[model samples]
Target: MTGIRSGSLVAAVLSLGLLAGCGGGSGNQPESFENFTAEEIYKRGEYELENTRKPKDAVKYFTEVERLYPYSEWAKRALIMQAYSHHRARDYEEARGAAQRFIDTYPGDEDAAYAKYLLALSYYDQIDEIGRDQGLTFQALQSLREVIEQYPDTEYARSAILKFDLAFDHLAAKEMEIGRYYLKRGHYTAAINRFRVVVEEFQTTTHTPEALMRLVEAYLALGLNDQAQTAGAILGHNFRSSPFYQDAYAQLRGHGLQPEARGDSWLTRVYRQVIQGKWL
Candidate 1:
């Protein structure tokens, strides 16, 4: 439901035809489906997913294949289908469980990459918005990292990298939101803490320039002129072309100050690293 759904109508019909070639049974009832062969049951699942769009029903049929033919090839295929179906049905918890089971059971299989991707997607899809709890964002990052690290050669890994960047950016966006809120309320120290996280932990994200500018604003409001200048120094060194850097520079100049590392605060340490080419 989140991201793109795979498979076209033609592909679904072709898959159904292939599964039908393996067996010949058309059952509508649960009892009748139980009596069908694994291939026949799998074909039914495909039909539910593609034809009727009843992903929950598809899950039932796929589960039957796993139950009736646990050691068969159909069982392995059914397990993955079960994961996909649960995801399509928006049952991310079930999707994650099925995908994780597939990964744990068939770590060496070709489908293992896909299973891991699906597991990561289960977490990734749940990162719907920045205002939501960040717990899922962290889980998504961890899972996406696994895909990138373990299955680097796969297409899923490439996609995982893209999604990982977005998720990472999402985290930076949340910090900026909280930092701006504190800044707007004149809570300079609280705002500084939030911005510091963006500078230190999430500096690679697009929010860094703005975070540094916010630090300048907060430090100036608190009369910490040295820290303000240090923040402006970092902004100018790395993001001199950015509008945020321009704003920070103007603010520093308006106060008869300039971007300089003049204090032994944390920001001054960052400035030291910047000048040493060890910080971004």
Candidate 2:
């Protein structure tokens, strides 16, 4: 009986092997292109990204080429492609690092300027609207400044200057936004300080006239009538054609103050006398 059982087990094992052979289950298949060169790997990656539109899959291949052939020309191409893949994926932090790496590693290379440009673009694309946190906007502005200063002859530098102007305008707008908040809350002193900053520091920006107008309003609210009149005069002189000048003039007149062109107001003269402990 034991010999009969052992014979049945042996037949079962033999039948399983026969089925595996019939199913073409070869554990040792011949390798094709298993020893591909670094150039071949880079070409495959570039083809995947350009032709197949598979940037995500191509990233892995490009990274592998870069890692395996760091000294080869193909490796340099792969590094750039890898950075582009990160940019296309909207992974801005990684994209920024990769682009910076390329610029640092190949400063004399023809593509160095392009790599710096991509680094700036990575930050620029991350900027949010005026109402949101402006951390990214500030970062974008800094990156663009670097591009303009370091690569002044590059096409990227021209575009960076334009973008930097817009960024400065946006930052000025943020200061105005905060000043308006203070004005609405009747924190006249704080509002005046912020508006003054915009008018004096960011005077070249588009928001300068608006900021000067806010300063006049804030001074009037604080009962600093002399300051309000001075602000109105400055506004009228600098922005003679601005609608804000007309509004500021109206505000001064509404406060029962005459528009005297050259002399100090009676109230200002009186206040100065009082502060100096003089009465006439």
Candidate 3:
């Protein structure tokens, strides 16, 4: 998962120190924190994060600011930083909780966009590779979509858009990965199902050309010449110069068929949309 930026985190950490509110309680552990003002505790969290590079320790102080001065604006600011600290420490669940609470309690706050973005990042960052469960990628897409739609004018929205695209592509890559695995295992039907997902739903992704090519291979293996030709036709229609298209063309020729969409297959619909501009 992506951690909070040290520069932004430090700036946010220091900014809250400008606010006013003191902490006091004899029973509180760490006598310094007990006596420090809310801003001071928040500052300590910043120091821990920036100077000490100890985000786990930083989270402690930021959490304390909210607990001790829950009503202060510093508390609100600290809550977001607390989320950042948890994220930097790789405590994704805690980061998500703190960020979600910030959004819930301060929906109209300027930092709400950042909080929501952080919540999305919590999931996005977890989607490391194609092997990971796609559930996190789906969650990231939903959260990022909310950010893009809800706060379009914000900087966070712009970043969310980029991340959303990357996550979407990642999902397609996962499908390609599984399809390739099944294809190598000689499971043509299973492989075709996986490749079809990329070709249909993830058509805009970079994986689409390769997915179409894989469909050609899988269908040919299953003795489905019409489906194979249709897949090759779609690949050639949109990605003619691509290596995948070249490969599909070569494979179709081996079967004494040419690349042309001539069946009521899923690829034929894509050919209509992409080639004939007939999308509904």
Candidate 4:
């Protein structure tokens, strides 16, 4: 569904008529379609997809091919193309169903990789802005993980890996957003909980530096000077070049203190674990 759905595949679909030469002309005729061979009907689907740009009609023909000859090789190819056609038409649920069916029926087929990718994309493409429910993002992450782990050498895996990282970062960003909301309302402990999730569980995310800096803000707001100072110290040590670290340093300095690990708070535990090889 991303980036034009492969124009090369569309081109090949359009060329199927020439390759077979049996029903190229009468394939689109509804009256002739029922009498057409499996390949001919499948080709008609591709013809609608590439030439007429009618995916709904393409899906009709593709589905018919699958229904008429469920065990034929053309049925296998038609089923996957049905998924592609549904995806191109933005019928994501239908696309997912067709894609999942293809994967279940032909797990070892070469096109199964493509079917799995389509299934993952069915979820990945639904992710909206951060304010929406993150259930879709979580599903996207899981499906993308499948593509990465099961087909790591494929191009689909590479794309899935990239999307997986972005989805992971999106989760961290959501935590940061809620953390900032709590911090703005002076709910320091609630804000700290959200920021800590990013620091501890989402350390690789870009939001971690900001989360640590926010911990400094929240702890300082709660008058937990040692915790605030320790948070600032961790920010400066791990993300010295980050603007968040600089802001944390300024926040600590404003309190007549400086960045140093001088607390027994959770952040101090993190610092000990990271800097002193101590487990908490």
Q: Which candidate is the best by lDDT?
A: 1
Better of 2 and 4 by lDDT: 4
Worst 10 residues of 1 by lDDT: 1-10
Report the C-alpha lDDT of model 4 over 183-232, residue by residue, as the tens digit. 99999989999999999889888998899899989988989999899988
lDDT of 2 by residue, 9-94 (tens): 78655643443233234562313223455666666666667876877766766777777778588878878778888888787888
TM-score per candidate, in order?
Answer: 0.88, 0.74, 0.87, 0.86
TM-score quality measure for candidate 2: 0.74
Q: What's the C-alpha lDDT at position 98 in model 3?
A: 94
Best by TM-score: 1
Taken over the whole model, the C-alpha lDDT of each candidate is 0.90, 0.74, 0.86, 0.86
Among residues 3 or more apart in sequence or in different chains, the pairs in candidate 4 whose N, CA or C atoms overlap within 3 Å are none
Predicted candidate 1 versus true structure: per-residue lDDT over 34-78, tens digit per residue: 546788788879888999898997898799899888979999999
Ranking by TM-score: 1, 3, 4, 2
lDDT value, candidate 3, whole model? 0.86
* Clash totals, every prediction: 0, 0, 0, 0
Candidate scoring better on TM-score of 2 and 4:
4
TM-score of 4: 0.86
Candidate 3 runs further than 4 Å off: 1-32, 278-280
